[model samples]
Target: MDAAFIHDNLEIKFLILYIAARVSRPIPVEGMQELTLCDSGIDYFSFSQCLNDLVRTEHLTLSDDGLYAITPKGLRNSEICESSLPMSVRLLTDRNVAAYNQMLLRKEQVRAQVTPRKNGTYTVTLHFSDDVDELLHLELMAATRDLAQGLADRFQKNPEQFYTRLMDTLFPKE
Candidate 1:
Protein backbone atom coordinates (compact mmCIF):
# COMPACT_ATOMS: atom_id res chain seq x y z
CA MET A 1 0.00 0.00 0.00
CA ASP A 2 2.62 2.52 1.15
CA ALA A 3 5.97 3.14 -0.56
CA ALA A 4 7.97 2.02 2.47
CA PHE A 5 5.99 -1.21 2.79
CA ILE A 6 6.46 -2.02 -0.88
CA HIS A 7 10.18 -1.28 -0.68
CA ASP A 8 10.62 -3.52 2.36
CA ASN A 9 8.78 -6.38 0.69
CA LEU A 10 10.87 -6.10 -2.46
CA GLU A 11 14.08 -5.93 -0.45
CA ILE A 12 13.13 -9.03 1.51
CA LYS A 13 12.51 -10.96 -1.67
CA PHE A 14 15.78 -9.74 -3.16
CA LEU A 15 17.66 -10.64 0.00
CA ILE A 16 16.37 -14.18 -0.18
CA LEU A 17 17.40 -14.46 -3.80
CA TYR A 18 20.79 -12.93 -3.08
CA ILE A 19 21.54 -15.46 -0.37
CA ALA A 20 20.45 -18.42 -2.45
CA ALA A 21 22.51 -17.22 -5.41
CA ARG A 22 25.62 -16.61 -3.35
CA VAL A 23 25.54 -19.94 -1.53
CA SER A 24 25.45 -21.89 -4.83
CA ARG A 25 24.21 -25.00 -3.07
CA PRO A 26 21.02 -26.62 -1.96
CA ILE A 27 20.22 -25.08 1.42
CA PRO A 28 17.64 -26.43 3.80
CA VAL A 29 14.80 -24.21 5.01
CA GLU A 30 16.13 -24.22 8.55
CA GLY A 31 19.52 -23.01 7.28
CA MET A 32 17.88 -20.23 5.29
CA GLN A 33 15.77 -19.28 8.32
CA GLU A 34 18.86 -19.16 10.47
CA LEU A 35 20.60 -16.80 8.07
CA THR A 36 17.64 -14.56 7.21
CA LEU A 37 15.26 -14.62 10.15
CA CYS A 38 17.42 -15.41 13.18
CA ASP A 39 20.67 -13.75 12.19
CA SER A 40 19.41 -10.90 10.03
CA GLY A 41 16.24 -9.91 11.96
CA ILE A 42 13.91 -10.62 9.07
CA ASP A 43 10.40 -11.43 10.21
CA TYR A 44 9.92 -15.19 10.25
CA PHE A 45 6.52 -15.09 8.56
CA SER A 46 7.74 -12.70 5.90
CA PHE A 47 10.77 -14.82 5.22
CA SER A 48 8.65 -17.93 4.85
CA GLN A 49 6.21 -16.16 2.60
CA CYS A 50 8.97 -14.87 0.38
CA LEU A 51 10.48 -18.35 0.11
CA ASN A 52 7.16 -19.84 -0.91
CA ASP A 53 6.57 -17.04 -3.36
CA LEU A 54 10.01 -17.47 -4.87
CA VAL A 55 9.35 -21.13 -5.44
CA ARG A 56 5.87 -20.48 -6.77
CA THR A 57 7.12 -17.85 -9.19
CA GLU A 58 9.89 -20.22 -10.39
CA HIS A 59 12.66 -17.95 -9.16
CA LEU A 60 13.81 -20.76 -6.87
CA THR A 61 13.31 -24.48 -6.86
CA LEU A 62 12.58 -26.70 -3.87
CA SER A 63 13.72 -30.25 -4.12
CA ASP A 64 11.84 -33.22 -2.70
CA ASP A 65 14.57 -33.47 -0.07
CA GLY A 66 13.48 -30.03 1.19
CA LEU A 67 16.51 -28.10 0.03
CA TYR A 68 16.18 -24.87 -1.93
CA ALA A 69 18.37 -23.81 -4.84
CA ILE A 70 18.22 -20.68 -6.88
CA THR A 71 16.95 -21.02 -10.39
CA PRO A 72 18.42 -19.18 -13.34
CA LYS A 73 15.71 -16.56 -13.05
CA GLY A 74 16.57 -15.98 -9.41
CA LEU A 75 20.28 -15.71 -10.22
CA ARG A 76 19.65 -13.23 -12.99
CA ASN A 77 17.39 -11.14 -10.78
CA SER A 78 19.91 -11.09 -7.94
CA GLU A 79 22.76 -10.14 -10.25
CA ILE A 80 20.75 -7.29 -11.65
CA CYS A 81 19.39 -5.87 -8.39
CA GLU A 82 21.93 -6.85 -5.75
CA SER A 83 23.29 -3.30 -5.52
CA SER A 84 20.05 -2.20 -3.87
CA LEU A 85 21.03 -4.28 -0.81
CA PRO A 86 23.40 -2.73 1.67
CA MET A 87 27.00 -3.91 1.78
CA SER A 88 26.67 -4.57 5.50
CA VAL A 89 23.78 -6.93 4.91
CA ARG A 90 25.71 -8.72 2.17
CA LEU A 91 28.72 -9.14 4.47
CA LEU A 92 26.58 -10.53 7.25
CA THR A 93 24.97 -13.00 4.88
CA ASP A 94 28.40 -14.10 3.69
CA ARG A 95 29.57 -14.74 7.25
CA ASN A 96 26.48 -16.72 8.12
CA VAL A 97 26.74 -18.76 4.93
CA ALA A 98 30.36 -19.64 5.73
CA ALA A 99 29.44 -20.71 9.22
CA TYR A 100 26.54 -22.80 7.94
CA ASN A 101 28.84 -24.45 5.40
CA GLN A 102 31.32 -25.36 8.12
CA MET A 103 28.53 -26.80 10.26
CA LEU A 104 27.36 -28.93 7.37
CA LEU A 105 30.86 -30.24 6.74
CA ARG A 106 31.30 -31.15 10.40
CA LYS A 107 27.91 -32.86 10.42
CA GLU A 108 28.81 -34.94 7.40
CA GLN A 109 32.15 -36.12 8.78
CA VAL A 110 31.24 -36.94 12.40
CA ARG A 111 28.12 -38.19 14.13
CA ALA A 112 27.14 -39.38 17.60
CA GLN A 113 23.99 -40.78 19.14
CA VAL A 114 22.86 -41.85 22.58
CA THR A 115 20.08 -44.37 22.95
CA PRO A 116 18.54 -45.49 26.22
CA ARG A 117 18.25 -49.19 26.76
CA LYS A 118 15.41 -50.99 28.55
CA ASN A 119 17.94 -52.49 30.95
CA GLY A 120 18.68 -49.11 32.56
CA THR A 121 21.73 -48.44 30.50
CA TYR A 122 22.56 -46.36 27.46
CA THR A 123 24.25 -47.09 24.15
CA VAL A 124 26.50 -44.47 22.68
CA THR A 125 27.27 -44.77 19.00
CA LEU A 126 30.11 -42.77 17.50
CA HIS A 127 30.62 -42.66 13.78
CA PHE A 128 33.12 -41.09 11.40
CA SER A 129 32.59 -41.29 7.68
CA ASP A 130 33.85 -39.81 4.48
CA ASP A 131 32.11 -39.31 1.20
CA VAL A 132 32.39 -42.92 0.07
CA ASP A 133 32.98 -45.13 3.09
CA GLU A 134 32.67 -45.18 6.85
CA LEU A 135 36.02 -44.78 8.56
CA LEU A 136 34.97 -45.67 12.08
CA HIS A 137 31.90 -46.92 13.85
CA LEU A 138 32.22 -47.52 17.59
CA GLU A 139 29.54 -48.44 20.06
CA LEU A 140 29.83 -48.38 23.82
CA MET A 141 27.42 -49.10 26.63
CA ALA A 142 27.26 -46.79 29.63
CA ALA A 143 25.47 -47.34 32.88
CA THR A 144 24.10 -43.80 33.05
CA ARG A 145 22.69 -41.33 30.58
CA ASP A 146 25.19 -38.68 31.59
CA LEU A 147 28.07 -41.02 30.96
CA ALA A 148 26.63 -42.00 27.62
CA GLN A 149 26.19 -38.38 26.59
CA GLY A 150 29.68 -37.50 27.75
CA LEU A 151 31.15 -40.29 25.67
CA ALA A 152 29.16 -39.16 22.67
CA ASP A 153 30.31 -35.58 23.10
CA ARG A 154 33.96 -36.57 23.47
CA PHE A 155 33.74 -38.79 20.42
CA GLN A 156 32.23 -36.02 18.38
CA LYS A 157 34.92 -33.61 19.49
CA ASN A 158 37.85 -35.93 18.75
CA PRO A 159 36.84 -38.89 16.66
CA GLU A 160 40.31 -39.11 15.16
CA GLN A 161 41.87 -39.82 18.55
CA PHE A 162 39.34 -42.53 19.31
CA TYR A 163 39.95 -44.17 15.95
CA THR A 164 43.72 -44.04 16.45
CA ARG A 165 43.52 -45.47 19.94
CA LEU A 166 41.32 -48.27 18.69
CA MET A 167 43.79 -49.12 15.95
CA ASP A 168 46.74 -49.08 18.35
CA THR A 169 44.97 -51.37 20.79
CA LEU A 170 43.81 -53.75 18.11
CA PHE A 171 47.15 -54.09 16.28
CA PRO A 172 50.19 -53.26 18.35
CA LYS A 173 53.29 -52.88 16.20
CA GLU A 174 56.30 -55.11 16.92
Candidate 2:
Protein backbone atom coordinates (compact mmCIF):
# COMPACT_ATOMS: atom_id res chain seq x y z
CA MET A 1 0.00 0.00 0.00
CA ASP A 2 2.97 2.27 -0.07
CA ALA A 3 2.32 5.20 -2.37
CA ALA A 4 5.90 4.89 -3.40
CA PHE A 5 5.31 1.24 -4.07
CA ILE A 6 2.53 2.30 -6.41
CA HIS A 7 5.01 4.37 -8.37
CA ASP A 8 5.86 3.70 -11.99
CA ASN A 9 8.16 0.77 -11.25
CA LEU A 10 5.73 -1.14 -9.06
CA GLU A 11 2.72 -0.27 -11.17
CA ILE A 12 4.45 -1.73 -14.16
CA LYS A 13 5.30 -4.84 -12.22
CA PHE A 14 1.73 -5.28 -11.06
CA LEU A 15 0.43 -4.58 -14.53
CA ILE A 16 2.67 -7.28 -15.90
CA LEU A 17 1.44 -9.83 -13.42
CA TYR A 18 -2.19 -8.77 -13.82
CA ILE A 19 -2.04 -9.17 -17.57
CA ALA A 20 -0.24 -12.49 -17.34
CA ALA A 21 -2.74 -13.81 -14.83
CA ARG A 22 -5.72 -12.70 -16.88
CA VAL A 23 -4.48 -13.88 -20.24
CA SER A 24 -2.86 -16.99 -18.78
CA ARG A 25 -0.08 -16.43 -21.18
CA PRO A 26 3.54 -15.58 -20.95
CA ILE A 27 3.47 -12.06 -22.37
CA PRO A 28 6.40 -10.35 -23.96
CA VAL A 29 7.46 -6.93 -22.70
CA GLU A 30 6.32 -5.16 -25.86
CA GLY A 31 2.91 -6.78 -25.80
CA MET A 32 2.49 -6.25 -22.05
CA GLN A 33 3.23 -2.56 -22.17
CA GLU A 34 1.31 -2.01 -25.38
CA LEU A 35 -1.86 -3.83 -24.40
CA THR A 36 -2.09 -2.75 -20.77
CA LEU A 37 -1.29 0.96 -20.99
CA CYS A 38 -2.67 3.81 -23.02
CA ASP A 39 0.87 4.79 -23.93
CA SER A 40 4.09 2.86 -23.88
CA GLY A 41 5.88 5.91 -22.59
CA ILE A 42 8.10 3.99 -20.22
CA ASP A 43 11.55 3.90 -21.68
CA TYR A 44 13.06 0.57 -22.55
CA PHE A 45 15.98 1.20 -20.21
CA SER A 46 13.74 1.99 -17.28
CA PHE A 47 11.38 -0.87 -18.04
CA SER A 48 14.21 -3.34 -18.37
CA GLN A 49 15.77 -1.98 -15.23
CA CYS A 50 12.56 -2.55 -13.33
CA LEU A 51 12.22 -6.00 -14.77
CA ASN A 52 15.78 -6.83 -13.86
CA ASP A 53 15.40 -5.43 -10.37
CA LEU A 54 12.26 -7.47 -9.81
CA VAL A 55 13.84 -10.60 -11.21
CA ARG A 56 17.08 -10.13 -9.30
CA THR A 57 15.04 -9.44 -6.22
CA GLU A 58 13.10 -12.65 -7.00
CA HIS A 59 9.73 -11.08 -7.79
CA LEU A 60 9.41 -12.27 -11.38
CA THR A 61 10.70 -14.92 -13.71
CA LEU A 62 11.40 -14.50 -17.40
CA SER A 63 11.36 -17.26 -19.95
CA ASP A 64 13.85 -17.93 -22.72
CA ASP A 65 11.15 -16.79 -25.12
CA GLY A 66 10.89 -13.43 -23.30
CA LEU A 67 7.63 -14.28 -21.62
CA TYR A 68 7.30 -13.07 -18.06
CA ALA A 69 5.39 -14.48 -15.13
CA ILE A 70 5.38 -14.03 -11.39
CA THR A 71 7.69 -16.18 -9.36
CA PRO A 72 6.58 -18.14 -6.34
CA LYS A 73 8.12 -15.45 -4.20
CA GLY A 74 6.27 -12.75 -6.09
CA LEU A 75 2.94 -14.52 -5.90
CA ARG A 76 3.32 -15.15 -2.17
CA ASN A 77 4.30 -11.57 -1.52
CA SER A 78 1.36 -10.20 -3.50
CA GLU A 79 -1.06 -12.49 -1.73
CA ILE A 80 0.28 -11.44 1.66
CA CYS A 81 -0.15 -7.77 0.82
CA GLU A 82 -3.62 -8.33 -0.67
CA SER A 83 -4.77 -10.41 2.27
CA SER A 84 -4.25 -7.38 4.48
CA LEU A 85 -7.52 -5.98 3.15
CA PRO A 86 -10.85 -7.44 2.11
CA MET A 87 -11.05 -7.69 -1.65
CA SER A 88 -11.45 -10.13 -4.51
CA VAL A 89 -7.81 -11.02 -4.11
CA ARG A 90 -6.86 -14.60 -4.92
CA LEU A 91 -3.84 -16.59 -5.89
CA LEU A 92 -3.11 -16.96 -9.60
CA THR A 93 -1.51 -20.17 -10.77
CA ASP A 94 -2.07 -23.21 -12.93
CA ARG A 95 -4.08 -24.87 -10.18
CA ASN A 96 -6.65 -22.06 -10.18
CA VAL A 97 -6.67 -21.60 -13.94
CA ALA A 98 -9.55 -23.96 -14.67
CA ALA A 99 -11.91 -22.37 -12.17
CA TYR A 100 -10.87 -18.89 -13.20
CA ASN A 101 -11.42 -19.74 -16.85
CA GLN A 102 -14.86 -21.11 -16.15
CA MET A 103 -15.78 -18.01 -14.18
CA LEU A 104 -14.48 -15.78 -16.93
CA LEU A 105 -16.44 -17.72 -19.51
CA ARG A 106 -19.63 -17.37 -17.52
CA LYS A 107 -19.01 -13.66 -17.18
CA GLU A 108 -18.57 -13.33 -20.93
CA GLN A 109 -21.68 -15.33 -21.71
CA VAL A 110 -23.75 -13.13 -19.40
CA ARG A 111 -22.31 -9.93 -20.83
CA ALA A 112 -23.35 -10.96 -24.34
CA GLN A 113 -26.97 -11.30 -23.29
CA VAL A 114 -27.33 -7.97 -21.47
CA THR A 115 -28.57 -4.64 -22.76
CA PRO A 116 -27.07 -1.41 -21.55
CA ARG A 117 -28.94 0.92 -19.27
CA LYS A 118 -29.64 4.57 -20.14
CA ASN A 119 -26.32 5.44 -18.58
CA GLY A 120 -24.65 3.05 -21.01
CA THR A 121 -23.90 0.58 -18.27
CA TYR A 122 -25.14 -2.98 -18.47
CA THR A 123 -25.83 -5.50 -15.72
CA VAL A 124 -23.93 -8.78 -15.89
CA THR A 125 -25.96 -11.83 -15.11
CA LEU A 126 -24.41 -14.80 -13.38
CA HIS A 127 -24.88 -18.50 -13.87
CA PHE A 128 -23.61 -20.32 -10.85
CA SER A 129 -21.59 -23.47 -10.53
CA ASP A 130 -20.97 -25.33 -7.31
CA ASP A 131 -17.32 -24.41 -7.49
CA VAL A 132 -17.79 -20.65 -7.29
CA ASP A 133 -18.63 -18.89 -4.07
CA GLU A 134 -20.76 -16.28 -5.75
CA LEU A 135 -23.15 -16.39 -8.69
CA LEU A 136 -22.83 -12.96 -10.26
CA HIS A 137 -21.48 -11.95 -13.59
CA LEU A 138 -19.26 -8.89 -13.23
CA GLU A 139 -19.11 -6.57 -16.18
CA LEU A 140 -15.70 -5.10 -16.92
CA MET A 141 -16.83 -1.59 -16.04
CA ALA A 142 -18.54 -2.65 -12.85
CA ALA A 143 -15.51 -4.67 -11.85
CA THR A 144 -13.23 -1.71 -12.46
CA ARG A 145 -15.55 0.60 -10.53
CA ASP A 146 -15.49 -1.72 -7.55
CA LEU A 147 -11.70 -1.95 -7.74
CA ALA A 148 -11.36 1.39 -5.97
CA GLN A 149 -13.47 0.35 -2.99
CA GLY A 150 -10.57 -1.58 -1.51
CA LEU A 151 -8.23 1.33 -2.05
CA ALA A 152 -10.80 3.69 -0.55
CA ASP A 153 -10.99 1.51 2.52
CA ARG A 154 -7.27 1.96 2.99
CA PHE A 155 -7.56 5.71 2.41
CA GLN A 156 -10.32 6.14 4.95
CA LYS A 157 -8.23 4.38 7.56
CA ASN A 158 -5.29 6.69 6.75
CA PRO A 159 -3.74 6.02 3.40
CA GLU A 160 -0.23 6.79 4.51
CA GLN A 161 -0.38 4.33 7.37
CA PHE A 162 -0.34 1.27 5.15
CA TYR A 163 2.16 2.88 2.82
CA THR A 164 4.41 3.56 5.74
CA ARG A 165 4.10 -0.02 6.82
CA LEU A 166 4.85 -1.21 3.31
CA MET A 167 7.78 1.13 3.07
CA ASP A 168 9.13 -0.39 6.23
CA THR A 169 8.58 -3.81 4.80
CA LEU A 170 10.17 -3.09 1.43
CA PHE A 171 12.60 -0.17 1.70
CA PRO A 172 12.63 0.37 5.44
CA LYS A 173 12.62 4.16 5.19
CA GLU A 174 14.26 4.92 8.44
The TM-score of predicted model 1 comes to 0.70
Question: Residue 119, candidate 1: how far off, in angstroms?
Answer: 11
Note each model's CA RMSD in angstroms.
5.0, 18.3
Candidate 1 CA-lDDT value:
0.83
Report every candidate's CA lDDT: 0.83, 0.49
Tens-digit lDDT track of model 2 for 1-174: 111223366655554455455554555777555543422434555566776777788777788988777777777766545433212222322224455456455443332233345675544332222244533323333333244344333333443354456557978657
Residue range 20-126, candidate 1, lDDT tens digits:
98774699998888777533346778789999999999999999999999999999999998888777777777888888878888788899999999999999988
Residue 47's lDDT within candidate 2 is: 63
Q: Candidate 1: lDDT of 33?
A: 80
| Winning model by lDDT | 1
